[model samples]
Target: MTKDFKVIDEYYEAGRKALKSYVTGFVLAIFLTLVPYFMVVNHALTAQNLVWAVVLLGVLQFLVQVVFFLHLSRNSRSHWNIIVFIFTVLIVAILVAGSLWIMYHLNYNTMSDSPFNTNEGYIPQ
Candidate 1:
């Protein structure tokens, strides 16, 4: 009996295509990233618009980079890749939330009674 299995050239070709696509997308994303900077310098975008534009495009660019470059899928490692992805997301969420919580506590809630309040650093007038 002869084996009918073929070698995996498809993945090579697919990987090349994916790499090309990722590079193109990364270039485009870089261009988009520069837009807000230019707009802010020229006074074309307001502060709010500039920030929102950068944030939205940053998210989009991140997804693009992940999808094309990372090639994450349900089939990968029999779905273990998804588990890793989930873990990474959880870590990022926790980091962001923890930072915010700590900053809020140290800045406002916990410092509410400090002697550095208001009357300790002034002079006479």
Candidate 2:
């Protein structure tokens, strides 16, 4: 085949692969979203189990977006890209977890039911 034809064929193949990846990602993302939504709406799982299930599905959706949408393949050329992505994820996780921890502590400490709350709903007339 001519050089021009070869380049065109490669471009066509890449486009096909990208379209497939996007469709698959979209389907998986929808399934993940619907599963959690239904689980919550139908009370399919207990509260603790529901929370875990939703979290697991959310993580799966995140991974699907990363792999299919971001196209972060494990090719040698993209090694640095993968490393940078991992670092970003780690930093985000750390920030989220730390913030949640701080918020939980703050809420627990200041809640009306806490032992530190001495007023006990007493009112002065």
Candidate 3:
């Protein structure tokens, strides 16, 4: 029947689209991974800049996986998926920032340069 043929065609098209999306995601993921790896192996960037670059690439790779593999998007009918992702990102960011802040303060306060800071008084003036 013509109706059955139409349904089959739609399925075929969907399959092709999904495959293309997966391939594109794979290429992007490879690129993101290699760039950071080379940067580290070659010492192409300073420690701070390399860290930021790697982090940025990691985020991009994550996004590619989410969109292509997980099929999460604003246009999707399940709005909750995107919402949940946003919430997760927010929670993670808060945790990381809070932890870093605590660690920095702890290190700063513990390494006091006061007069009693271990053998300073005994050293030759």
Candidate 4:
């Protein structure tokens, strides 16, 4: 029957689309991972540049995972999930930045040579 054929076609199309999506995501993830590892193993970049590269790749990998594995999208059905993910990312960024800032300041202020540090006097001048 035509109805049966239509149903089969729909399923076939859906399966093809799902397969394409997964293949694309897998390839991208593999490339992202390999590039970073190669750079690190070969010392292909300076320390600062390498760090940035790895971080950027990591972010890309995360996005790929979200889109492919988690099936997140901008569709109305997934809008709430997107919003929540963004909020969570913002909160985590703020927390990490604040913690790093505090640690840097603490280290700087507590250095042995800092005149205002109470412990500075205990060290032999």
Instruction: Tell me the deviation in Å of residue 110 in model 1.
Output: 4.2
Per-residue CA lDDT of candidate 4, range 41-115, in tens?
A: 999999999999999999999999788767787268988888999999999999999998886666655546656
Assess the local accuracy of residue 114 in candidate 3 as a C-alpha lDDT between 0 and 100. Answer: 62
**Taking the tens digit of each residue's C-alpha lDDT, what string does model 3 give over 1-125?**
99999999999999999999999989998998899999999999999999999999999999999988888862668698788889999999999999987766665556555665453223322
Angstrom error of the Cα, residue 44, model 1: value is 3.1
Please write out the lDDT profile of model 1 over residues 10-125, one tens digit for every residue. Answer: 66777788778778877877876787667768877778887887788778877766665676641457487778888999999899999987766556544355556554223322
lDDT score of residue 17 within candidate 1: 83
lDDT of 3: 0.83
> What TM-score does each of the candidates earn?
0.62, 0.76, 0.81, 0.78
Local accuracy by lDDT, each model = 0.69, 0.85, 0.83, 0.84
| Candidate rank order under lDDT | 2, 4, 3, 1
| Candidate 2 structure lDDT | 0.85
Which regions of candidate 3 deviate over 4 angstroms? 112-125
In model 3, the worst 10-residue window by lDDT is: 116-125
Spell out the clash pairs found in candidate 3. none
